[model samples]
Target: MKKSFNGNNVEICAPAGSWESLSAAIRASADSVYFGVEKLNMRARASENFTAGDMAKISRICRKSGVKPYLALNTIIYDSDIPEMKRICDSAKSAGISAIIASDIAAIEYASSINMPVHLSVQANVSNIEAVRFFAKFADVIILARELSLGQISGIVRAIEKEKIIGPSGKPVRIELFAHGALCVSISGKCYMSLAAYDTSANRGDCYQPCRRRYIVKDEETGFEMAIDNQYVMSPKDLCTIRILDKILDAGVSVLKIEGRGRAPDYVSSVTGAYKKAAGLWNKGRFSISAAKKLEVGLESVFNRGFWHGGYYLGDKAGEWSGISGSAATLKKIHIGEILNYFHKAGIAEINLSAGGLETGDEILITGHTTGARKMKIGSLRIEGKSAVRALKGQVATFPTDFKTRKNDKVYLLVPSS
Candidate 1:
């Protein structure tokens, strides 16, 4: 891992929407995991958020695995949300949460009053050194505005050190950057398109993502309408920095955050693992162009709206808009079936094929709440004690495996995209 100016290794923070994604992040060697609980977070409507009751368990899991857990309470807070916010913060503090990622002043002030560590969320749109110094009074870490350039970020980092600005922890404030994930066309993701259209405020955690859809431009005077040409104009491509990760590390960032709390467990696992490997390679001066390309291929196999560096980091003003309405991942998952039983001693898993069939040499992914995400290839298969090359739908098949899979774990076959 790349070390920041403070000599601490840069942290890789992954996102978790569910227990499965949390486990997957840990399995992929994430330094920390951030997640939403209840409706007080930005991904509240997009993900299966944990309840306040789940805080202890989540903290315990992360503690046992040596991964820090950050509770995201960064949505726009209303007066009615004060009680719930306080309850959640109390729960997090009691549960030993590492930190709270917050944007609203209400959440930040309450968290500070309770003496709990806080990390400024991107919603705060902190862009300048003065903003960092101000937030440093309440937070130990600050995620800079996504619109800032590398030169700007470097300047802020330098100012933090030169100005001797320290956080509530009495240590130098850490800077975090969004290393990879979906990019919003809005400035620092503070858009009100959802609220303007559907009465659902994106700031309140219920984003209707009107930007991801196709739109038609209509002439109000002439009643002439024309569809935009093959582009989701408002939706920018997903941000990918693996190619320029060394430059990011050189900027003295203390944390690399992967944003996907609403995505699948496998997506978390794949992206976190890729960044982890890339960071390690970078520290050893082995992050060559070929290595980055290989890691990028692994990334493209997962969920993405097409990859772009974004003008924010490179200082290009033009937008890299998404051409498609959804993911342009190179590989897609096909639901095959679920595991019926696992014969531990025999190292075999009995599966009931409910949908698609599986053939030898086919790669399969097994995902579950406890199992997380596990991928393996089918070397051989058996059906009713007879050796078989393929297991069709409705057939009970047994396959040898190295890892243990739990009952009801969904299985998927990875296939090439059309």
Candidate 2:
């Protein structure tokens, strides 16, 4: 972990939408993880949310791994939804969750009444010092608005220290920033395009993502139609700050949050590992341009809408839009098979190949609720107790592995994207 200019250890906060993503984040060295449950979070419709019964298990796993767990209850609340919202907050507190990330005043006040810590969500659009001072009454940490410049963030940080503003924790309020992942074109993600187009409210966590599609302009009188060539005009490029991480830390930001609760396990692993490694290098004074560039390439192997430094962070007034429709990842995974059994003592795994064949030296990935995301190269292969160079479909192959894998874990082969 790197230390910020204010002498606080910079934290890497990762997103987890499922057990697989949570496990991957822990293994990849994330200091804290945030997740959604029971359709009360901003990513509710985009992710496979956990149930109330899974709270204890999630807390236990995070505690055993020395990672803090945060439950997100940031969605807009209706009068009818208050009962369920309170139930979730009470459950999180009883289960030993570190904090609740919230936006609505109702959720914030409810959590505070139960003595549970709170971190203000980005949906609050806290941009200036006065907003920080106001929200400091309820939240110990406030994720600043994504559209602020570095100078604005630094000013707010300085104000917190000078005014001696403290939260319910009796400590000065800390500032968190979004260091990577999807960039919403709307102001602090308060968008109505999804609701207006698909009748799904983004504030209620059910956005249809209509902004990522292509569009054209039509003239009413002339009957002319012109397509926006080769660009998704409403979609902004994903934020990537590995190269400028030191600058962000120098700005006195405490937490670097990655925004991807809807992503896959491999995406969670790759992004978390990349940021962790870059932070370590920055702490050691080894985060050179070449090293940062290499890390960015590793990030490109996973899900992304292309990379760009956030416009406002760099003092730019215009947005950098994505040229393509979907992810621009350099590599994609193909389903190969599933695990049949694991020989723990022999350090071997027996796999039932249902699709693509596996060859020696081939790169493979295994993902499951327990196994997480494990990537390794095949050293040798054996089919039906006979030595072989390759294993084809419908055959059971045994391969040596240093890590434990569970039965029914999905296996995949890595291939270059077209």
Candidate 3:
């Protein structure tokens, strides 16, 4: 698929922790989706990692949606892990994964053996043009280190183009950067705090997030201990570049990636949807400050960690991290109703309207384990078997839908901003 920017194609890669997230990303207009394999992916514990069978299913779903699926083999590996790695590579190849993001050299070699397109993971920390040039020999795409500033990224891209360093595809190595999501206090893939605190390697997909924990300061000579001024001193606020997206685009990156695989389908939808719209406007030179503020508000409405900043992309001017709580202050989503039953042939779904009643003409998103966020307007609503304009908070309502809704699926009313 050709991902376009402005009039040119550029990818808007979204995270897929589950099938619901995958569907949400696609519906939100993500150009591509990235997910992890079971057991060996960086988000193995955080996400519902795909099994071999699940990979084939994912491939079909992505293909049907016209979105490319990239496998995340981007985790530390051991010598004994090669066999499982190769098996995964073979499976991903058969499943038609667009590429495999790998951090370990052995994992890269194994993926290369299967002729899968390799993307150097952010774990590799490709900061300089020299590193980009070196990886160009093997990797089709390079996910630049998160610590890089726009100036640094621009220089690297220029140097690569000037040097004519070609990737496996006989074209310049594609640059992908994290445009939104959680920011790690430690450098990407270089942290040993998790290892020291939990005896689990962060690189091996087993981080216990020691950085998000409170710590006490101690003076060894006096043998005195004092609580830190702020508890979550290590955690940084989440990254939100909606305000300076055009500057990021000028840095010559091909893909803008959102970083939330452990997040819900709603999160994936809201974040990706906002960025997708903003990037399109930016490309067309139609983006404005008012539009950016609106987009920022929409992003915060989904989930956030207090506030946002440009992160390392703005260099030291990005300012001090404000997230002292080491946790996301996600907004509480309003509940409209929950699915009770569905009369499939009748194209009607019975919902127990418990909170915030729904009115006719209101926009809603239906989400569940199997029901990937389906968005539609309430054309009609019935309460207690009677045609009604609205369903009260305590009423059991039924509504006609174009898609089948499963039991337990949640209905969220999308209220227009005043």
TM-score of 2: 0.97
Q: Candidate 1 local accuracy as lDDT?
A: 0.92
Give me candidate 3's TM-score against the actual structure.
0.88
* Residue-level error in angstroms, candidate 3, position 292: 1.7
> Which tens-of-lDDT digit does each residue in 290-391 have in candidate 2?
898888887999999898865578778646889888789998899999999999999999999998799999998999988888899999999888888999
How well does candidate 3 score on lDDT at residue 210?
77
State every prediction's TM-score relative to the real structure: 0.98, 0.97, 0.88
Q: Rank the candidates by lDDT, best first.
A: 1, 2, 3
Per-residue alpha-carbon lDDT of candidate 3 for residues 1-418, written as tens digits (9 for 90 to 100): 2233222466799999988899889888998999997888888878887787788888888889899999999888888888899999999999898999998888898788778999999999999988888888789789998899999988887787777788988877788999999878888889888889779888888888777666778899998998655766776778888888888877778889999999888889888999999888877778777898888876876656755567888885443565455334334556877999999799999989878788899878789766777777899988778899987898898889998899999888765433
Q: Whose lDDT is higher: candidate 1's or candidate 2's?
A: 1
User: Candidate 2: where are CA atoms >4 Å away?
Assistant: none
Best-to-worst ranking by TM-score: 1, 2, 3
Residue pairs in collision within model 3 = 3-9, 3-10, 4-8, 4-9, 4-10, 5-8, 5-10
Off by over 4 Å in 3: 1-8, 218-229, 317-319, 322-330, 334-337, 341-348, 353-365, 374-381, 387-395, 400-408, 412-418
Q: Model 1, 122-196: lDDT tens per residue?
A: 999998997997899999999988888899999999998898899999899999999999988898857999999
